[model samples]
Target: MSKSEYNTEDFVLDPEFRKWVLTNDPEAKRYWEEFLSTNKSKIQEVEKARKILIHLSQERFALPDSEIDLQWNMINDKIDHMEGLKRQTKVVSLDSWSAIQHHKEQSRQKRKRNFIRTAVFAFSALGCFIFAVWFQSQKFDDTQEVELSYETMEVPAGVKSNYLLPDGTEVTLNSQSKITFEKNFSGDIREIELVGEGFFDVAEDSLRPFIVKTQQVSTQALGTAFNIKAYPEEPISVSLIRGSVLVTNSEVSDFKEKLVPGEEMFATLDNSTWIKGQFDLKQALAWMNKTLIFDKTPFITTVHSLEKWFGVTFTFENDIPKNLFVTGEFKDESLKNILDGMSYSSRFSYTIDGKKVNLKFKP
Candidate 1:
């Protein structure tokens, strides 16, 4: 039969479709996804088949060939028996018409009840099958459902990583950052846990809000591009570049802040309080463009930034400067050049040996 003519049972029986749903075969996945996208009418059937396979697989059992054959045979026999009863009607002579009419009425009622019972049996079985399939597909009932498995992606220091999430959201992970999310985003919410920094271009999913949870705060967005800086020991800063987002503190129950484009929310580790204000887009998002900007940033803060950017370790050879600051912008520059520029303003000398750097201040 043509694919257009394929029904739910056909999809469930097809080996390729079963492989895609059960084993997540990549080739099968690609073919079925493309097919379903073009043949929208088959989408529901395919989903039903997928859910059935998942349910059956999780049960650690499959319908035996004999059992399946028996079920089909029983249904066919019941249908044939009903048809035979329909053809069993006969005419009676008028001489005994009263008695004959009464007998015929009783038989008619008996047939009706039997037919109703048979129909109910058939439909009830089908309904239960479909219900089991749908129940297995739902991941929203946390109280009864198994906990979803999550996968974590970590970007090593000195290099950034770009990825497309399961829901088509684009993520740019900065160095020394990690993101953990459900394998397929299978729940009512598409949520992720983030450590360090990353930029998110959220895919628009109105039914399921996208949430990014940090150590002390959580940012929820429906469809927006935002940047988050959540490194350890520093204030968690969420900057909304486009669209709006709701920011909430994890520690405080009544802390909720809404952010618009060009706005940023900051939550310090020290307290449950948070602050929101207008953000400088150019400075806030400079890292995404392979640039770093410092506006009179502290010398030690600059060192920490360099450590993550270049995957290096810095050591102070002498007493650290009590009051020193550096201001500069470096775009895709070498580590040596950045240090050289900062040394002029901060009166510091630095030596780079492999992945370690030594800094000395001139007295």
Candidate 2:
């Protein structure tokens, strides 16, 4: 933080600063926004410098033949302009170097003019080099001023989104889910926090492991493909499709659970604990296929699942039968049809109110 030996170059190359840029940290963005807002006058030249530097950086950077021609033309043009200017102002002896003895034969006046011509380009070069360093600094300062904010986009029903993480992991976020990652995923540990459901196809980086944290549990993997379900009202669940995963709850004494392909572990709420069980991959992941598989699932839990999967709400009034086990599978069924099926079983009757459904016992 000392300014005594403050080298801007060191600041530009600082690993943490670069990492913040890469991650697009909101705090970093806010700091830059506040700093630039306050330091506008002191860094005004940075604006000009950034415009030119950004254009230069965008040019196809390579030792191309066209670039060589461009450089050559610039040098030739500078030499031509100086010689032409000298001709208009004052003529200089071209043979000054040939004969100092011949200088007297020419004139002292022309010798002085010739020296002035030679000094013109030398001063221009020095001036240009000086400006080049200043201009470069301006670009770096502009970068410091630029505010970058990283955000997570929510996925809605009937649509899926695919995105890349900094660590090259591929995430296919399901409807109503989101994933937030640190700007520098390659820090001590590559970690992401997931809300709702997502399918991860993580690229293998052995040196730094990948971790996904939810409300109830944390999943660690070296490289794998898996589905995570962690809706707030629903149980926290993970189903590994391929590779391996280790899940642990920070609160529990024995929290570690190893999951293999086609296996799942669900963490329940409050007094309810984690359930490690074998699951049929197709039945477990039927939602992804736009199918609902309710094999021996309770009517109450089934209603909750329907609410979340379709972004609907359910309510029950009056006394309702406890443990009204509703089981079966349905694909793309209408809400009325689903409710009617449950009512036929004399378990619960329901009526739809906008996106919400009210349930009660038959009178």
Candidate 3:
């Protein structure tokens, strides 16, 4: 039969469909996405099949091809038997019995009908028992745990993005950030590795704590909203907006600190000690609102932020002023406008050509 006519069972049995559901194959993903797009009605069937495959795959005891075929054959045989019984019973109508001999025959037929009903009920009960046994067996077998496939998402410099995780957590990724996460949150913990900065509105899962792992630290939260800035070579910062988070230094696994609302944790990659204190939420989350807020920030740091914010490469034509600091807020401002504002105060001339900007400090 054509793929469009496939039912849930058919989809589950399909090798290509199972591969797409189990492994992270770009070709399989592209094929299935295009298939579902055209065949919209089969979406629920495909999803149901995908879930069944995922469950079976996690248990590491998926039905073998031969076993699957055998079970399906048995099911089809049972269905055919039920149809035959229905046909036989349909021919014997109540109106057909009239004479004395016929009444005797009807009495015998009634006994046969009762026997058929009992047989059908027994078969159904047996099927239910078998299903229950299989389900329970799969549920409690914890000897083997399989590793799940992971996928990575990267946002290039000068562009910010947002993504929804499998567990319904909302993530607002800042410019030049990358996040690597599991394709599905089937593990004990909903974990993700982040590079650069991201704001997480974590989904509440009491059973599975949402964890954001940076190079030097790991932040664990359950139903909390927080932000983490962990760009390479820069100090890592975890700013909690609401709820609470437990921050642990990866280098010093014994070191852990709990953070409450409005608190921020700062840890340098080069240092083992971390500091926690109150933070400015607006300043921390300014990128989310397409704004940049500088609080007497060093010129080099400000340039780094601007480079990521506008997707530009900055080159110093002359020696950068060591005393230069910028303090301002620019919301949805052009790169030229921001540069102009900064140049007026910092006494620097800059030329923007394509993606590169050259800065010359006025003497």
TM-score, cand. 3: 0.67
Q: How badly does each model clash, as a count of residue pairs?
A: 0, 2, 1
Report per-prediction Cα RMSD to one decimal: 13.2, 13.7, 13.1
lDDT of 3 by residue, 127-175 (tens): 6544643564445333455556898989999899999876668999999
* lDDT per residue (tens digit) for residues 1-363 in model 1: 877788877787688988776665668877887887688888766765655565566565445677667766776687678757765885445667767886797698678757766786678567766665545545423355644578999999999999988667999999999999986665568899999999999977554699999986889999999999999998889999999999987678888899999999988898655788999999988988999898888878888999999999999879878877778899999999998888887778889999999999888
Please, what's the RMSD in Å of model 3? 13.1
> Residue-wise lDDT of candidate 2 within 75-170, one digit each (tens)?
667666765786698644567565675566458645654565457646655455445544566554333533323446578753567888766688
- List the lowest-lDDT window of 10 residues for candidate 2: 52-61
Looking at model 2, residue 194 earns an lDDT score of 91
Evaluation by TM-score, superior candidate among 2 and 3: 3
TM per candidate = 0.67, 0.57, 0.67
Pairs that collide in candidate 1 are none
